[model samples]
Every structure is written in C-alpha cells, then in structure tokens.
Target chain A: MSPKVSQEHMEQRRAEILKAAEKVFIEYGYERATMKHIMDAANVSRGGLYQYFSNKEAMFETILEEGLSLELDETLEMLKENATSYWDMLMKTIFGEGGEPDDEMDPLAPAKLEFFIIGRNDEHRRAYGKTRYNNGLSIYAHIIEDGQRSGEFSKKFDHEIIARSIIAFIDGLAVEDAMLSREDLRIKEQSVLFVEYLKMALGISEHSTDGK
Target chain B: MSPKVSQEHMEQRRAEILKAAEKVFIEYGYERATMKHIMDAANVSRGGLYQYFSNKEAMFETILEEGLSLELDETLEMLKENATSYWDMLMKTIFGEGGEPDDEMDPLAPAKLEFFIIGRNDEHRRAYGKTRYNNGLSIYAHIIEDGQRSGEFSKKFDHEIIARSIIAFIDGLAVEDAMLSREDLRIKEQSVLFVEYLKMALGISEHSTDGK
Candidate 1:
C-alpha cells in the first residue's frame, strides 16, 4: 500500500503548478500556449497536471482569480492596519508595488487581452469575465470610498464612476501596450497625466508630496 | 471582349467591396473572417477580390484607413469653416454624432480590438497600428489645443496628455464591451462622469449649457 498524500501537500503542489503555468502564459500568450508547454514548464506528468486543471482555460482562470484575490486581501489588510496614506494606497494599487508609473507593463497583459477578447463569445468565458471585471472594479471603488469618508477625496463625482474610470484608463493602457511599442506608449508621461486627472477629480492638491 | 473599366468606375467598385467586407468583418470578427466571405458579400469573383486586395489584412487595413481619413477630413473642414463651438466639436468627435453619452457602442469595436491585439507581433501590422494610433491621438489633441487657444479650455495640463487619456478611456471601454453585457458597463453613466472630469480638467463651467 502507498502512503496517502496530505491535504497541505496537495495545496502546495497546486500552487507550484500555477506559478509555472503563469510563466508559460506570459511567454506564449493565451492562444499559442498549450497544455504540453505547461506540463513541461511545471515538470509534472500528464496525470498530475490533469489532476489539478481540466483544461488550459481552467488553469488560466485559476491563475487570474488567485492573483487578484491575493492582491485584494493584502490591500484590505493594509487598510485595516492603517499602514499607508490613502494617496499611496491608491497609487500602489493601480501602478503596482512601486506605486509610480513606468515604461514596463505587466508581461501577462497580452495574454489577458487574448483570453477575454477571443473567448468573448463563449458563455462560460463571458460569465467569468464579468465577475473578474467587477472584482477589479471594486478594488478601486473601495479605495475611493475610504478616501471620501476620511475627507481625503472629494465627493464631486460618484466613487463608483471614478473607480470605473481608473479601471478604464488602466485597461485601455494595457490594450495599447499590447499593440504599441513602449516608446510610442510614453507610459510614464501618460501615467503622470492620469495622476493629475485623478488628483483633480479626487480633490487632492497637486503640491501634496507626502505620498511620493 | 471584356470591357475596359474607367478609373472612376474602378474606384467605385473598390469602395463597394470595402463596404461589404466591413460587414463581413463585423459579423465574423478578425480571426474567423475569410477572404471568401468578403468575396461572397461583395458579389465579386475570386480574381476580382484578389486584384483589389491581396489578403484579408490588407482589406481590413484599407477599410480602417479610409474611415479614419474621411472622419478626419470632415472634422478639419468643420474646424476650418468654424461651423461649431469647441466643446461641441470635442463632444461630437468623441461620442459620435449625438455628442452625448448613450448605451450604444461601436459595433466594429471587437473586430478592431482583435485586429490590433492579435497582430501586435507582426512587423507590418505593428507599423500600421502605430500610424493609426498617432492619427487617432491627433484628433483629440487638436481639439483640445484649439479650446485652449480660444480660452475655452484651461492650460493647466498638457493637451496631449489629456488627449491620450481620452483615447485610453475609449479603447478600454471597447475592450470591456467585448466581454461584458451592455448593462454591466453602465455606458451612459460613465460617459457623463467622464464629461465632468473633462470639464474640470479643461476648466469648462459646470453650468455651461450652450453646446447641449
């Protein structure tokens, strides 16, 4: 008789597979990347890979879901601890860990675009995309709401609308980044301009230098 | 003997083919759309279609180029003739002929997104996309510059950055529209809010009602 695998061990194995799959997706994009690539990348047998994910879409979806949830949890935890200013919280949430715009875009952006745009017609994908959009929307909305409550942000515009606009700007940049060169995108300039827009919309003073 | 076609007649025939091809692309999107579909839709022989456009990509590019140029020409003519207010010009240009936000979105948006995002890795396609992006960018930038010159828009922010943000918002919305239902997007509400953002950024008065 073989020894049984522990539940904790299974979870660890699943996490390892997801990390490998993400790298494959980033390199090959959504359409070209295949199960075989993931298998090789993860160094797992066919049965082991299949045991964790039924198909490529499932694996991709799991990666996105897990990453988003993890980020959201960390953000909420940060807020609970009052460890950062509202401005820094907003910037970091939108622009990544540095909380400042730069030339580098998320490497997974192209694959994410392909997955959602190409699978748009599929009922399952459409439903998944909707949930993902809402989850993304709420992350920004929650921050703006907190800022507004604390009088750090103006209530001139609805918090949800402001949040949605932020998502639109970021999503738009991702779409452009997928097609245009970094130089053409002028990512830093655009981000700085958008930061100005956010400041104007949120009533943050231009001279406020605390967050930087 | 085959009749010799006049140059004007040939141009008209090409225009008809492009119109039909546009319909086919909207129906099937970029990847699934085929040259045969365009041939059938345009009621042209295979040889005739080939004589005009070498491939589906060329045909699609021609359609986009023609559409954008036509719109640009019309806009420039209106500006030269001083036919409308700066605010009206900006609104009509961004939100279509109605000049107000509504539930409707561009029907060709998904196809356009697919074309740009999928072909991003191709050298020739990348070149075309960059030109198209710059052309699109200028439309908004020119209007904002005019507004600032006329003292209608503020000069606090760079006109180019604001213009870039507008393009980003529209492109981002198109991406979202491809995957989400119309209701989920809250199109009109988002547009109204964006208009407010624009007004604040440009220093347009909240009570200005002449353009509406």
Candidate 2:
C-alpha cells in the first residue's frame, strides 16, 4: 500500500505541477496543451499526473483560478495596507508594494501582460472577466465610495465609473507592458505620472508633496 | 451585359464590406470568420468579394487599417480646425468631435470598445498589433513630441513613454468598456472625463468653457 502524502509534501507537489502547467499552458495556450505535455514538462508519468489532478480542464481551472486569484488578492491586500494617500496606494500596488524582486524590476509585468492576453482571448465566456471584476471592482468601488462618504472625494462623477476606469487603465498598462515595443513602453516614472493625472480624474486631491 | 461600377460605387462597395466585416467580427471573432461569411454578410458575391480583396486577412486588415487611419486623420483635422484649447480638442476628439451622431443615442462607445479589444488582444501577432498601434501610439507619440518641441508641454519624461501611457489610459477605458457590465461600463461622459485627465497628464491646461 502507498503511504499517505503529507500536507507539506502535497503542497509542494501541487506547486511543482502548477509551475510545470503554467509554462506549458502559456507556451501552448489552453486548447492546444494536453496532459502529456504537462506531464512531460513536469517529468511525471500519466498515472502520477492523474493522481495530482483530474484532467486538463481541471488542471487548467486549478491553475488559472488560484494563480489569478492569488496575484490579484496580493495586489489588493497591498493596496489596503499601503494607503498613506490615494496615489501612494496605487503606486505601491502597481509597482510592487512588497519591495523590489530579485530583478529589481517588475516581475509581475510579464505575467500581467500574459494575463491580459489570456483574459481577452481565452475563448471562454465573458463570465470569467465579469467574475474577476466583481471581486476586484467591489473592493475598489468601495474604496472610492468610502472616500466619498468620508468627504475625501468630490461628488463630481460616479465612483463606480471612476473605479472601473482606473481598473481599465491598469489593465491597459499591463497589456502594453506585454505587447508594445520595449522602446515605446513607459518607464516606471512615466506610469507614476499617469497615476498622478488619474488622481485628478478620480477627483482625488493630490498628495501635497507629489505635485513636483 | 454587366453594368460597370463607378468610382463612387467601388468606394461604396468597399465601405459596405468593411461595415459588414466589422459586425461579423464583433459577433464571430477573426479565427472563426471566413471570406464567405464576410461576403455573405456584405450581400456581395464571391467574385465581388475577390475583386475588392485577396483574402480574409487582407479584408480584416483593410477594415481595421483604413477605419482607424480615417478616424485618426479626421481627429487631427478637428484638432487643427477646432477652437482654442488643448482640453477642448481632447474633449471633442475623444468624445465625439464629430459631434453627436445623427439618429443615435451613441454607438461610438461600443464600436470603439470592440476595436480596442481586437487591437490589444495577444491572439493577433505582433505585426498586426504593430499596424493597429501605428494608427494609435505612433500618432500620439508624434503629437506629444510635437507638443514638447513647440513648448506646449514639459519634456521631463520620455515623450514616447508618456504617449503610450496616455494611449494606455484611453485604451484602458476602451478595454474596460468592452469588459465591464453594460450598466457599469465607462460611458461617453466618463470617457470625456478621462480624456480631460489625459490633457492634464500631457501638461495641457484645462478648457475654461464646455464644448456642449
């Protein structure tokens, strides 16, 4: 009889599979990737792959659902904890609030770009984007709504619309970071300037010192 | 004997095919669509379709390329002709410098939103996005570079970077408009608002007077 897998071992095994699956899926895309490809990438046999997950779709759902949700969740959490001013929070979240990675550049930029392509061309129903929006939009809309409620924001326009616009702006940047010519893409400072302008659009008062 | 089509008739036929292609593309996306689908949708026969274009890819390119160049040229013309301020130019160009379309509440929002997704999605290769963005980022970069050279704007940042950021903001709004709930999408007014923000971002002063 096979000994039961420990929880830690199970977690490691799952991560190993996900890492393997992500590369394969990204390289091959969803429809073209198969269990064999994933197994070969992971260096696991068919039985071992099935032991870890049910099938390709199941593997995909597991991969996508957790990866996307976690990336977004982490970003939102940073936004929540980093609120000295509105732009501070946005910059922190977007430019990586956790401090520089090993590369000292945005590691997420590549993945975020990948997400935009995947999000747009997934061939899935619109529900996927809608669902992610519902999770993120409500949180962000509430932030704007709360600011308005607290008299920190002007009532010049709809916060819901503002939140959606901001999200869209971020999405746009992510896609650009992925697809645009490296020479044509904005640097970190340029993106920060954009957030400054966005602060005005959302009717957020600029942080006193950042006006420079 | 077949009647010879006039110059105006040929132009009219091309426009009709593009319009039909746009509609079918919005419904069916590029991969699933065929030349036959566009030909049928345009109410033109096989020979008529072939006379106008080589293949579905060529037809798609014609529809997207010419449509955007026309839009960009028209926008630049309005910029050249419109009244005094940068803000007004942005508000007008982005929010219907064409002025409200006759016989419609508003269709440009959805129409543009559709085109933007098609432009930004990764499903299309770099070359296709390259041509589309030439009508977008390349044009905006030229304008910004001109603005900086003429002393109308600051040059503290890379003009191309800022231009792409501004485009990203607009593209973001378009992306959001396409992806969000209809009731929740950024409407024309919000789009106008973002364009206003864009003017400020580019160091253009706000318009004191309203367009409408």
Candidate 3:
C-alpha cells in the first residue's frame, strides 16, 4: 500500500517536471536548452530531476510522448462525443475552442521541429519520429474518414489525402514559425485561411467570417 | 590575358566543388556531412576547396543562394512569359514542369530543413532563414495577385493567405519528408492532391487526372 502511494506521487512529480521542461525547451530551443535549465524551471534539485529522467533527451522524449499522444487522444475523444457537426468537430480537433485565432503560436513547436529535423540522420530517432508522425497523420485521417461515413464531408478527394494535406499545412506553419518572427508569418491568420481551404476541399459551406 | 582565362577556369572549378558538396550533403545530411567527405566527393584537395569556401557553412550558404533564388527567379520569369494559364503557371512555379508527379523527392530538402531548423537557436542563421522564407512567400503571393488581376483566379480568399497556405503545405511536406520514409508520406502524390485542393479553393475547374 505504501509503494502504491509512492508510485502515484512519483508519476505526478514526473508530470510536473515534464511540464516545466517543455517551457524551458520552448524558450531556449532544444540545442541551447540544458538539463540545468530544466532543473531550474521545474524547481527541482538535480537528484530529483534525474530520478525521473536520465538526461535531457530522455526528458524530451517523455515530454513529446505525453504531449503528442495526449492531444491525439483528446481529439479522438472529441470526435466520439458527437456534440457538434463533423466539420465543427474536425475544426475543433485542429484549432481548439471553435477554431478561433490565438494570440500566440504553440510554444513547443520549435522544439518539436528541432527534434524531428535533427533526428533525420539518427537511425533510432528517425524510427521513433516516423511512429509519431504516422500516429499524427492517422488521427486526422480517422476524423476525415469518420466525417465521410457520416456524409458530412465530400468524397471528391480521398480522406487520407486531405488529412495528409492538413498535416502538411500545419507542419509547414510550424516550420515557418521556427525560422521567422511571429509577425512575419501571421500564424493564426494563416491557420484560419488553411481552415477555409479545407472547407473548400471538403465541399463544406464557407463560414461568413472566413477569409474576412 | 592568362589572368582572364584563369578567372573563368576558377569559376568553373568553384561550381564543380559546390555540385559535389551538394551530393555529399544529401547523402550524409548537414550535421553528419564532413569536410573530408566533400573534399573526396569534389575530387579537390583541401587547399583547393578552401580557396573557394571558408567552411562548410559558407559552402552551404553559397549552394542555397544559388539553388533557392535561382529557382525563384526562374519561376517569376515563367509567370511573365504568359504562355500558360495562370493556374498552370503557378503549378509549374511550385512543382516544376506542370506539377507532374516525379519519381523522387527533392534531394536538397533534408539539408535545407536541417539548416533552418538548426538555425532557430542561432541569430545570424535565423535571420537569413526568415529572409528566404518570406522571399519564398512573396513570390507565390505575387503570382496569385497577378492572376487575380487578370481574372484567371477568383479573389475568393486573400491572395496572400493562399500564398501562405502554399508555403505551409510545401514546408509541411518537407518536414514530413525529413521525418517519414518516402513510401509512407507519398510526397509526390501529396503534392498532386494538394494542387487539386488549391484548385477547389481557387474555384478552378477540376482536371480529370486530379486527386487520383
């Protein structure tokens, strides 16, 4: 009984460390971010941090696993809830909260891109990256396939293709965000625009506010 | 004079070095690629190569400037030719030679992505990356604006937004290409499908071969 309680506490502590480490990685980027910075950000001693993660890479992999999979699970759950139209659900799954523009981009985007791009030359990292990317692609494709079955989306294009395009657009924006200043890229506006493009491709009626 | 002949020969030698360096970079990637690999690939002595480029980064920057901007300039010239429809011209500008599906992906994509993603933490690199990205965006936007003025494309959405979407989709594919194997992502097919999506968004007629 004591061991079980301690295990639960460790998991909670691990989550806290990941949360803080993500912020530090975002601010400083992956190459510049250090284990010391993570320890400082998490407000944990080196011993405490190392107890959960072996190194910065281990901490990053943990963060990515949690962040990427959690979002996928949440989006899938939203699809299952059936609270809105399929199109609305798709948009919500993508943009969150009625698909409105946000003031800032996802803070983790830079680190995420860094991980995958730098991982290209590494066999282990490349394999892991492929899994995460395919998982991401499947989530969006699954939503579109579901929408098609429900007659909410057009059958003009393959659902898989459209889903891939969505990934491409989102990934492209993240790439731009990594290299360019926020003002130069207009990430939010570009997202809304891509959503509009999705509507056209899916044969859905355009929203009045779209493209304005 | 012999000096004139020597200068022309030197220009030819520099071009040869860059071509070989590009091939080496493609195979090993930017981080893993060594100066020795370039020296071997180019068949130039270390002293001979150093005369042209001070370092690997310098070699890469020269390659990028020539490769990226030269393509941009060529596309812009194609747009000016007026021999093709605006949509066809735009497609050619993007995918080359009428947007046909090719057997292979862009060879330089991995290195280009590495340069920019790794640049996120470096001020000098980050600045150059932004300029290139924005320059790429504006080229697309300029073509779209021109098309709209000629009534070839409906001004349904802001041209700049569509332009950004184009960047996102292309960039996104590069990101996916960097991480996932070619078979899994189907980069060529995705590009073709995306062109179909752009057709719908732009209110153009669908081609029979589209979205296959």
Model 3 segments more than 4 A misplaced: A1-9, A43-48, A76-82, A101-103, A206-212, B76-82, B101-103, B206-212
Local accuracy by lDDT, each model: 0.86, 0.62, 0.80
lDDT of 2 by residue, B108-194 (tens): 333433333334435565567666666666666776677677676667667776666666766666555555554656356556566
Residue-wise lDDT of candidate 2 within A42-72, one digit each (tens)? 9998988888899876776677678667878
Could you give the CAPRI-style class of model 2? acceptable
- Give a tens-digit lDDT track for model 1, residues B163-196: 9888888998898889898888887888897887
TM-scores, one per candidate: 0.87, 0.74, 0.89
Candidate 2 CA-lDDT value: 0.62
Residue A187's lDDT within candidate 3 is 81
Worst 10 residues of 1 chain B by lDDT: B75-84
Task: Give, for candidate 2 chain A, the lowest lDDT window spanning 10 residues.
Answer: A99-108
Summarize candidate 3's per-residue lDDT along B1-212 as a digit string, tens digits.
69999999999999999999999989987877889999999999999989999999889999999998788677767667743677777788787765565536677887888888877778889888888877877878987898889887889888998888888887888888888877888777787777766776677776522432
Q: Model 1, DockQ value?
A: 0.71
**Best candidate (score: DockQ):** 1
Instruction: For residues A1-212, write the lDDT of model 3, one tens digit per residue.
Output: 69999999998998898889988998988867999999998999999988888998888898888777777787667667743677777777788755555646678887888877877778888989888777777878887888888887888778888888878887888888888878888887787767667777677876522432
- Specify the poorest-scoring 10-residue window by lDDT in model 3 chain A: A203-212
